[model samples]
Target: MVTSIASVCLSGGLTDKIHACAAAGFDGIEIMDSDLTVAHESPEEIRALCERLGLRIDMLQPFRDAEGVDEDLFADTLRRAREKFRTAQRLGTDLILVCSNAATATVDDDAVTARQLGELADLAAEHGIRLAYEALAWGRFVNDYRHAWRLVQLADRPNLGTCLDSFHILSRGHDPAAIEEIDGEKIFFLQLADAPDLNMDVLSWSRHHRLFPGEGSFDLVTFLTHVLRAGYTGPLSLEVFNDTFRQTDTGRTAAHARRSLTWLADRVATTDSHDDRRIPEAQCPHAVDFVEISGADLSTADHMLEQLGFTFRGSHHRKPVRLWTLGTARLVLDEQDKHETPHLSGIGLSVDDSDRASARAEALGAPPAFRRTHTGDHELRAVASPDGTQVYWNDQPAETWTEEFTGGDDGDSSGAVVDHINLSYPWQDFDEAVLFSTSVLGLDAQASSEVPGPRGLVRSQVMRSPDGVVRVPLNLAPPTAPTPPRHVAISCQDVIGVAERARARGLQFLAVPANYYDDLAARFALDTAFVDRLRRLDLLYDRDDDGEFIHFYTPTLGDVFLELVERRGHYDGYGAPNAPVRLAAQRPAS
Candidate 1:
């Protein structure tokens, strides 16, 4: 689960919200609709910025009150849904959040609400979107995962799904066992959060006193175990709506989040290792696609990962450098010079053993960057990556560990696994880059290919995990063409899925030329209807002998533009053959 967190759920709209979440150790972020609008940042701009920050927008949120509304209100809601859908499209996302109807809900009949939700589901499907209906604790119609799940079942639309919220689920006195009966696929989003158990209502408690996982009393371990047992494979977001968290130091808060999530993860691993009376690993078919790394500098990044004793995985073959998969999670290092003022190139890592994993990495020569000790508390070490990135590992006290490290935090975003990363290098030093990656970082070199360009050939290499779960492309600038650095591709099971979700979140995409699709139809022999659909979506296409892949290109921002991709099979290579075609399309008319 790429640790995702709700936007407003964290702090505020400032980069502080991002910084806190990152610092709190989240892998992806869920931008509330108002966050983008409030910041006066365009969806396209946010998409670009997140891409730059190395974060994924798990879901565009607060598509509240979609069901059980009057006709006029429903129309207005649907209109907003369409706008959010387009935002999702531009953001390169696939899930949109639809909280249960609140204020404007004119109707209270669950049956009628379910029917209306079903109609909305069809509408979402038309845009290739999934509506994850969250049952808020205060919601009138549905306020629990079971109730929401029942509603989803009633809707019966493929694109209609439920969101499992840790706060709401556990706060209502629901046990993890509630997850046992649900269909995993129908649970599109799982939100995990922890709060200091109090006498107040769970919703109010969540908004004021929620802590990171392991820091609270909720049985998140049981909850997450149940979620995993139910085979609910999706991103686990840390959606804490806490007032104190808003004022907490960004870096400290992020570190706490990392530690909390890591503790939960360790517990999950142990639970999975054991055969519990309630669930068995063999019976628990669901696996975490990826864990999240939210906050910390490159050194702290190193700290967050090394403390967990995670091994370095491979990185991408194109664009500015980013690496993935150390300690069972993905670490995204923010490489932008803008934040370089704080010199804050950040890190997020998912690890098997949050503590030992990070410690071992430090032993393997990670650079120590920060330290803090209170009373008899042992000094905590933050480390820097070989590239001078900062990160820290979780060292939550043993008791807190039991409380927070429960494989369940209630934030909301999905698509937890890392899809891919793009890296770039100088043509001259490309060989050294490959060597450093394959040997020092412990990744296997997959293949090298020549990208034919107008001037000459651009050579590159693909590196991946031995199991093939990670794929990164290393691209060296051709000596002849002076193009700048950029990230060129993203991996996903469903491009249309990402597109629809991105549309909902207000993401922006670069326009692709129609001629590209015409060429695709002529060359690939794809069904005309499919080609037309791709063209309309502005999605590009390519193929390897194993299968096909889709991609998109944008003008350079910093060193690279972003690529959103859907791979159909073992087509492991970058869609190299399509390189010339895409470049031609993206290049200004000369």
Candidate 2:
């Protein structure tokens, strides 16, 4: 399948967008009209650059408001179309996208619209160009793909056909199965985009909130399957109009866009057995083996862990790394890198087949990470995440690696297990990280939420394995706020007991405001003694119909923090409602 992206989905001038798309492995690009209009290069120069970069100019978009107009208006629209057709010819592309009138339409009759489109197609044919008419979701008269297809049929022109955009069709709740009924040859172009479910106006949502496929709530596999079933073998192009993508680095955004298409193609191929292409099945991790922290000086982290009930498991014989554990939660502190500051650096996942997981990640364009180990070591394969965090896969038991530690297996067991890991990313890396977690790491993205912070709103998305063993909550720091550090949460049967013991051991907890207890009293009918205990220990509480969640945080240790949680019953959430209070309390005072 040919992969393509619209130039409008990235930042920079026309030439820069083209170069980025080519470098990212895209086969072609749909050149947006505004990008070309503002570019310094002539159409011939743009064509030469695409050829030099081994990229094709798939389409010159969008010639808008061309149909459903009076005769005088139609004549002027044809004049505009003629100019664009000349430009398309010079740019070495044969297709032009004409979106249905969303602005000014003097006539609403289908016959008139069809006739005007036929006239425009006749004008386009003079320059050896084809017109792919699209219906915007907010178009004045024609707002559905079915309507647009009927108009294409009515026009009965060889050069005029309907363009199917997933956003315009699915955003309005239209059935996509009907696409199977349309002739494949009549479908001139196919544009794909996924988006979060929002209750705002269609125009605003389409322009600002559109996410790439597999990153949002759209059923793109089914959507693509139906299109393919109709025998449409054209390029699978992306036409996302996101505010963030438009302002991000053109090369990085293009790379992310390319990954999304590769993931979507693999998904579609997996669902259809008859398809020849097959990608590796997604790996399901059974447990988190360990979390590795690295820095020049990790003594402070070692002391903090000891205070929180973790017992030393001794240092690695061949490397400058030490292990600490609280029940099944293991922490590996690596001090080999003397130049780096304290940071949460790596994670280890236990899957059924580690080799297969590493191969799948490599197939999806993730770079392999290598580590120095002795010949007797149980080699762990790893890949670097988009945020520079290393993720290692291991199928062997803990004893295989634990035996390498000098101090032996006599460490304290605090009855705690890793509940989840929280990772914060800069605004630019958020979507790319989401795609990486879902496609490369084989995790499923749950519903996301926005939490209010001191600087602005923080967007959070949870990605987890199907069996609920592994969970990663990805936080996108507010664009205007400084990026926050990452943290880990460990769960125990009795958080109150653990907190009491840690406090007695001199572990400093993040202070809770006095008003929090009063608010908690108003929200839930809890015993006064329980509320008082929560306030005294700086604990936070949240309850849903299924269960209750109680948790508390420790003060930041360099760029990492810790949270102890107790989950009662089947609490599936991460206490999202309490996020604002936590963020506000964590903010530094002026």
Candidate 3:
């Protein structure tokens, strides 16, 4: 299956967009009319560049509001279409896309629509151009793909066929099963986009909130499967209209789009059981082996860890790194990256097979991250995530890597294990991070929520493995905000005990305001004594029908923080209700 992305999906001039698409390994691209109109290069020059870059201009898109108008308007539409058709010939593209009119279409008659489309097809044929008609989700008359196909059938022109867009169809909640009812040969193009479930009108939803495959709430696999079942074999192209992608780096956006199509096409291939393009199956992470903090000096972090009940495990034999462990939770401190403050720089995940996982990452275009390994040590095989964080995968438990740290207390009773990792990303990096968690690590993305914070609303989405052994919450920080601190949440057997011990060790926790306790009491109707104890220890609390959650946070140290959490009676949440209080209490890089 050849992969392509629309020029509108990326940012830059046409040359830059084409180069990024080619470098990102896309086989083709859809040249939007707007991109072409604004580019300094002529159509012939753009075509020559794409040829040089080994990219095919799949289609010239999209001629909008081309049909279903009065005789006067229809004449003007044809003249405009003729000019675009001439442009398509120069661009060396045979295909042109026409969108159903969302404005100025007074005629609701299918016969009129079909006749107008047929006339437009005749004009396109004069230039040897084939037209693919698509139904915009908010089109005046032909708003559904089924309706668009009916119009195509009525047109009965060889050069005219229907183009199916996943967003247009899925956003309207139309039945995708009807897609198979159309003739395969008549389906000329397919555009794919995934979007979160939004409550606004379709036009607004489409222009601002489209996401790539596997990053949103759409069932694109089933949608694509239906298209395949109908025998549509054209290139799989992406037409996302995300505001973030438009503003992000051109190369990065193009690569991210390519990865999404790869992931989607691979899934469709697996389900359809054909070898068009093979993507390695995901290697679901089994456990978080360890998280590493790196800086010029990590003495402050080291002290914070000890106060949180982590036992210092000593230094590595061959490198300037040390480890601390509390029960199954482990942290590795590296005295490096001298230019930056202490930060959560890397994470090691225990998977069933490291080699297979690394292969999957490579196939998805993740850049390989490297670290030196001395003789008789585990090779530090890793990949850099979209946000520059290094992700290391190992087949063995973290203790295998911890073996380098020779001297440590073996029998600690801290009763703590890594519950989840909270990573805050810039606005542009959020969707890519979500896709990374889904495609690379095989984690299931849960429903996302927004928490009000001091700066703005924080968008939170969690990606977790099947057995719930590994969880990573991806948070979308506000646009104007600075880089948010990343924290490691450790689930303990007893939260009050842990907080008391840390307090006894003279560690300053992020203080919770008194109003939080009042709200908790009002919300849950908890016992006064339990509420008093929680308030005294600065602990935040929440409860659902399933169980209760209690957690506390440490003050931010450099760009990192620590969280101690305790779950009672099968609670699965991350104490989301307490997030606002935590946000208000957190200092701004003090």
Pairs of residues clashing in candidate 3:
none
- Assess every candidate by TM-score: 0.48, 0.96, 0.97
Q: Put down candidate 3 lDDT per residue, 421-500, tens digits, no spaces.
A: 99999899999999998988789999999999888999999999999989999999889876578999999899899999
- What TM-score does candidate 3 get on C-alpha atoms? 0.97
Output the worst ten-in-a-row residue range by lDDT, candidate 1.
277-286
**Candidate 2 CA-lDDT value:** 0.90
Name the runs in model 3 displaced over 4 angstroms: 411-413
True lDDT of residue 589, candidate 2:
83
Instruction: Judging by TM-score against the true structure, name the best candidate.
Output: 3
Residue 407 of model 3: what lDDT?
67
* Top candidate when judged by lDDT against the true structure: 3
lDDT of each: 0.61, 0.90, 0.91
Cα deviation at 202, candidate 3, in Å, is: 0.7
Write one digit per residue (lDDT tens) for candidate 2, span 318-426: 8989998889899999999898888899999988888899888877777899888778988999999977899998898977887788874586566688999999998
